[model samples]
Target: MEITYTEAVILYCLKQLKGERTIFSLYHLYQGKKSSQTIQDAHLYHLTPFFQAFPFISREELARQIERMEKKSLLDKKSNEHFILTSTGDLKLGEYFQANTLPPKYLDGWRHHHLTALFWERLSILVQVCSNLVYQKKSFIPIQNKLETLDWVKAFIKKRQEGRMGLSSTLFLELLNCFQRDKTIDPSILVLRLTGQDRIGLTSGQAAELLGMDHTRYQLEFLNILHFLIGTVSDEAVEFPLLNALIPEAEKPVPFTLSTEKTFQLLNRGYTVEQISRIRNLKRSTIEDHIVEIALHIKNFDLAAYVPKDKEKRILEAAKETSAKKLKLIREYAEDASYFEIRLVLARNGDQKWK
Candidate 1:
């Protein structure tokens, strides 16, 4: 018998379904079981909800379909509540499924696609070049070898806009800073910024500023995009594990005696100020203060010996300049790192650590 697409779809869902009830629910009461007085009630109860959501199949209609199938020997009626498809049914269903699906060539990207891997691998190069455009809030005018980079930027933006990218607005805005203007940053440069000594990961709030949207809206939008990027189509909700990795775990403030050592250890372990607060039962603001103070001390310590002195000096200078205005300049700088980089020079410095 020729298998219909509808039949194939039903079979696939049935095979993949978990739990006895769900399986029993999807399948029509085939076997002589539904005719039995004892099992008939159970079949009707399970069948009701399924029918409502499905093609609104009536019990009479389903019985007729089952009878037809059985007559054709496509299904075997075992007991009152149980029915099994014959070997022909299995073969026909498999054939229909295979016929409906495209060849492997059409699914080439699916075999190796992972959003986090794609983002991390592409980000360093993409963000560095796009930083300029982001800072300028201007579209990339492709020239030189910048076309590929701009194309990537366009694609990334499109994905975000379509809710197919799981990035937060804070992250989106942070990303925009990299491509804001005509800045042609190398991927290595952006990578360095993320991995630098004075490194701080982008926050959800900061990401909101980047997208020019309110934090709450951006957060929802970002989560949806993440869902799309992660390829989830479940009726039940799922969270991406990569999100936890994106931001460090929150950390509590340590006293000065243990601050430096502890901060270094936590930073290496991906602990954020917020994480620290929860861990230490301290306030977030207090933890931030401790982290800032410790960071400053690290900058002051001839740990300059461990780093490139000139680059360190330049970074210190930029921080000093940004700090002078403090609030406004800091916000501006954070909002547009590509623009801030010229005046700031430390735009992509954090990425260096990964190298």
Candidate 2:
């Protein structure tokens, strides 16, 4: 089935998460919410790369797409908060994968960089120089205006040549193959233009007009394509030193908030939430929120430590019946189960199967 980019992205995210995800989490991921360290660490925000391509999409519009997808039987509403891809949706996504070379939202980690413009500028300049050199043209003017950048690119090219013969050719061929296989022509043309391929090469402004895209959208697409190429080539660096040198380092560790780290430390020491709250001079509710955040981030966190087996059984049953949407309704069904316990159960097991 033919699906819009938004629908395709939604399906891809659901499948990647094993066919189930909360609406809230999905929205936060696509909207690129920075509040949650766990989401950032996982590189879950896929929409940031295409902000210009999808300028019209908003959180509200995304929610509408989810509803539309559910109505189309592309997704099954498992609960008020979560949805799972249906068999039809799975088959459709499989078709998309078979037809498309580049995975949807492939350069999601680019959003994490603070100096994205510099990264792209340096990369494009390097590619242009390398492509020209491979074609045996040494007299071309530098695409980058800065003297420092020109010097750096010159030294970088020299180092690769000294390390291995045909390194530049190998890197350029790999990039060409990746772009040629892509479902979209824009990315391939963008890369070709940037690298100064003989017939198709054009300046950025000229390429944007040829592709019928605005300058911003064209630039965003080009950057995403470059990022994807860097990632793909970097993985095979053991065989391609030139590619390895071109790609940047992986993301740094995501830091937890001081309060959340303190709460985690206390919990690790076997302190009860109440005890932690008393010792830390915070409310019990605040302590519980910290525990939830910890459980969400730490895969092996023991939710059972706070919720007894019998009480967990009651909460799971109530959650299954009512979809875990409203905690108050769950509390009514699960008599004597504290709100915190209910929240914990929902947080840990809402999208997964209950024991």
Candidate 3:
């Protein structure tokens, strides 16, 4: 049987989304990959709302698409956990990968689409959150107990920003209004709600109090309404930031190279963070971070052989000079956290620092 252009393209998209089960699952469901009890549930409960968030297709249409994809063998229907791509799907995906290099616009700006979806997904849960808060407020005593209101708010924020839900601006404003009416609401709670930095969404009573109310049902309901608002219909278009949260005080940069280098060196030596902390005179968390940077640089260029020899030498030397003298100037402008201190250091040293 001859494959149509649309079917081929759909197959290609499926292959491109190889490992992201949620994404492929949505595509599979839309393509009509298979019809089973589990697939039905995934479609009705998970994929449907997810698609609604993007305003891409109706729930019924999505299921139909999944069935179609299954008939074509582009998507494997047997697995409940993930949508495994078939050989035909792989070949189609390879065709697109080779023939169509992504435009710079997509490469650079695709992140924004993802970030926006994540924001909206979280916002969807705000209504449920407020409804619950209202429930507690009306009930006289807190429904969740010493469980601070801020904690629930934090968890919801984390869930939404984490790209686990569809957030919306309307929901955001509603939440703000809730806090306004309840002046007792802490600003930290609001901060946690937006940034997902702290604990905000702890549940009432459970072994894992952290579980809180699994807002999946709440998310599903608001997901439909939000899709109409954002003006999209498919889960594919839904996007959120992969790394969209603030770094904590512990993550702040320290000003020394040997400290950075040694921390990394110890970590590479297979030392646990705690071991590294004890061995090196730095905090365990700080040592663990050094491991990350060291791994990044090594992955980019060989650190052991390159250090004090080639490109790595020049880079480190520059970093050190910048660290020792130039960095001191930026310390005064501490309030300007967004600015890069490395650049400030380089600017101060001018030609003297680069050698």
Candidate 4:
């Protein structure tokens, strides 16, 4: 069965999350939700970067798609807020992969990698240098102004030229072949146009104009192409040394604050939130916040200890009805629900408005 891009993305997200996920969590992963903290506080949740900029789909539209998929038996509602891929859904997802010439496992793994601002910065610089080198240009301005990044690129190009380590024309041809198989025109052109061949490549701005698109939109398309290329090549890194070399080695630190770590340690030791609050000299609300953050990041964290399953249902219902981010408003609808339970529901559901 054919699926829209949004449907495909949803199926892909559910598949990646191991075939079960709350709508909130799925949404968070799709759009790359960030933690509430400004300075990397303990309650902050680490988020993986996603291709949110290119897509015009909204949460409401996503919810509608989920409902439609469920009705079509492509998805099974495991609970009020959680969903799983049905056997039919799995088959449909498989079809999607086959149609796109993509490997499901690799796409899933790509979703988990932390694509940071620095990764994109390095990617832009690398693309520029590689493009110049491909065209046999002796000198060109680096995309990045940073000396360290320029030095790294220079060394990397030198190594490649010296036949030490780098991508070859054969690899570029393979990449182009892959791009040619894609449904969109921009992806192939973006790849070829960005990596110059016997001619200096166009800058992103020039490419955007040439493609009759705004610079920002063109950049988003460019990023989407780059992201797909990186993910696909990384999946076969053993065979594609050049693509593998471009993979960023820097790891993002776990999304836990020192205080949250203490809270998690205490909770693991069977300490109640109230007990931990007093022991740690922090407020009960603060401790609860830590638990919420923990639940958001750590899938195995036991939310049942704080909010019962029945209460969870009520919180979800209230949240859906009101669509309010404020704790006070949510509490009005879920009268018996404590602030902690409400927060837990919102966090698990990946509601960023409250945060």
Candidate 5:
């Protein structure tokens, strides 16, 4: 059986989850929900690489995919909202990936999504401008709409010592060198989306149709390429100066949601959770949610600050004993530990420390 790219992604996620999670947990993961449970689950399951990889996929659409997969005998319905992968499904997944490599390994969407998006926007406008300039054509509309990007392009180009022609050449050569270095990646999928002097770049759907690939597949491919470029450029910035310029700041471990970012700011200012809750006029539980979110992303966060060493040890032990990610399940075994403490432990260490 030929498993499609979309099927392959879902299958990979299901396998990682191992039916311990509800089907909708997959939905929330893709939707990139900011809830404490979803955020902790994304990290705990080791599925952070694909977090928010399909934010636009509707729940109904996901159900349809599951139904079709069930019909194909790739999924076994263990319950109304949970599924287990069949042995045949596992074999098929292995075969499918052997034939097609994808769902890029180092996505870090939970970490670099915002940075990736901004980098793409900057690259898009730069490409558009360079294309028009190559044809000696002016008066073309900018591909990027954000005022920040527009101003960035103006400021970026002005600051460059190279003239327009030299800048374009360097940009083109750097991109070529980077893409050419990776034989597994087909750069055409990405390049086809770039607007050139002769034509506007194709939309994602258009590019997918042209490539005879699924829309989801095309998107994953596109994102993988961006991540690939971001990684390539970051480490070799001196080699790809123009590419590195787009990512102006040192990347944060994970991009925080605005609310969580506010929480982080307070933590940085040496404010206690109770103090922040009162200052922000939010519930204590809500502030706790922010703290858990902080634990999930901030590597240096001291777990002992809120949780005593013994409680932390108990929670970790329970997670190992049961191999369960569910808070209720862990709470049952870790009777003395609260749900919040369990979450903090999971967020801090994820699956790595225990399992």
Candidate 6:
């Protein structure tokens, strides 16, 4: 029997994890946990693209999926929770992938997760509105009902320099340009889900069935196209100007959690982790998480303030020598490095891949 898309994702994560972590690590990774450790795991395991790829999944659902894999001999349980992929499992995973079963190509859950859904919301509403306005029709239900999104759309349309005809044409051209630039993208995945004028868009399940895909398969494909558009429009704004304007400006700079942003502002004024903890009335460990999260996103963020340069170098060296990301393992090689110091270095190394 063919493995399902969800199973493939689990199998791929298991392979990347290399039996070092428990199956639940994949669970948290898929959920896109906001914790520092979960964020670090995403990069350390080279699973950044798949991070938060399945936020709707429940722990019970994950347990069921793992049970299914075990039944298929794709996974062998070790110590109750940890699992190592069996040879048959590895072979199956390879075969499944060889069929071009739609593994993620441009997911980028790390960079674009926060904005992907929002962009699609704005685009969907804009498309529906433009479709009706160009035809001189009024009084239609909006595709998005969130008050914030509704307000944003109204503001967006009012700010547009194009008339209904010009807006529709430019939007069409910009969208066409985005898909054409990414030759691998299949626009039909998006078009099939989009609604316009009198035509209501298909529900995700409806679209998936129509395209001969499982709902999960269609979700992954749709995310790929969405992220690709976000990346393309961001990088080549001059090319997709109309679409570029749709990107949320507030989130344009950084995608920090609200609490992390609060810490970031204090950090800008030079608060020590301890001081930030005191100021925020949170534990020191919690503040440390904020610091690590900062290092993960802000590439130029200074670490010398937290970890000595020599120590940072040693931690990174140990990481390279062992080819291991687990703090306990790297600690053995860098005997003098503290776990916090090791984490600080790894956070940067995970992204930069420094030698």
Model 4 agreement with the true structure over 231-330: per-residue lDDT tens digits: 6566666655665566554233344667788898998898998899899999888887788778767766677888999998888888677655456878
If both were scored by lDDT, which would come out higher, candidate 3 or candidate 4?
4
Whole-structure CA lDDT of model 3: 0.38
lDDT of 6 by residue, 118-201 (tens): 889999999999999988998898989999998988888888887899999999998987787768778989998788989999
lDDT of each: 0.38, 0.62, 0.38, 0.61, 0.86, 0.84
Model 5, range 1-355, lDDT digits (tens) per residue? Answer: 7888889989999988878888789999888787877888888888877777888989999999999999999999988889989998999999988877645755666766767789889998999988888889988888789998999998998998888899899999999999987898888888999987877999999999999989988887888888889888888889888899988763445567799899889988999989999999999899889899888777889988889999998888899998878789898888988888888988898949455
Q: Which residue runs does candidate 5 get wrong by more than 4 Å?
A: 351-355
Clashing pairs in 6: none
Candidate number achieving the greatest TM-score relative to the actual structure: 6
lDDT for model 1, please: 0.38
Please report how far candidate 3 places residue 172 from its true position, in Å: 4.9
Please provide, for model 2 over 1-355, each residue's C-alpha lDDT reduced to its tens digit, 9 standing for 90 to 100. Answer: 5765456667876655443346656555544444433243233222334322333347787778889998888998887767888999988887877765334345544233333345556667877776676677767766668887787777776766433237556766665666665566456445546645253357767887887755544555665665565555555666545555554552323334578789888887888888999999999887887776666556678877889989988988997786533578788899899988887776666446432
Q: Rank by TM-score, highest first.
A: 6, 5, 4, 2, 3, 1
Estimate the TM-score of every prediction: 0.23, 0.51, 0.24, 0.54, 0.91, 0.93
Which ten residues in a row are the worst by lDDT in model 5? Answer: 248-257
Provide the RMSD of all predictions against the true structure, rounded to 1 decimal: 27.3, 7.9, 19.2, 10.6, 2.2, 2.1
Q: Which window of ten consecutive residues has the lowest lDDT sum in model 6?
A: 248-257
lDDT of 6 at 329: 93
Q: What is candidate 5's TM-score against the reference?
A: 0.91
- Runs off by more than 4 Å, candidate 1: 13-24, 27-55, 102-355
Which pairs in model 5 have colliding backbones? none
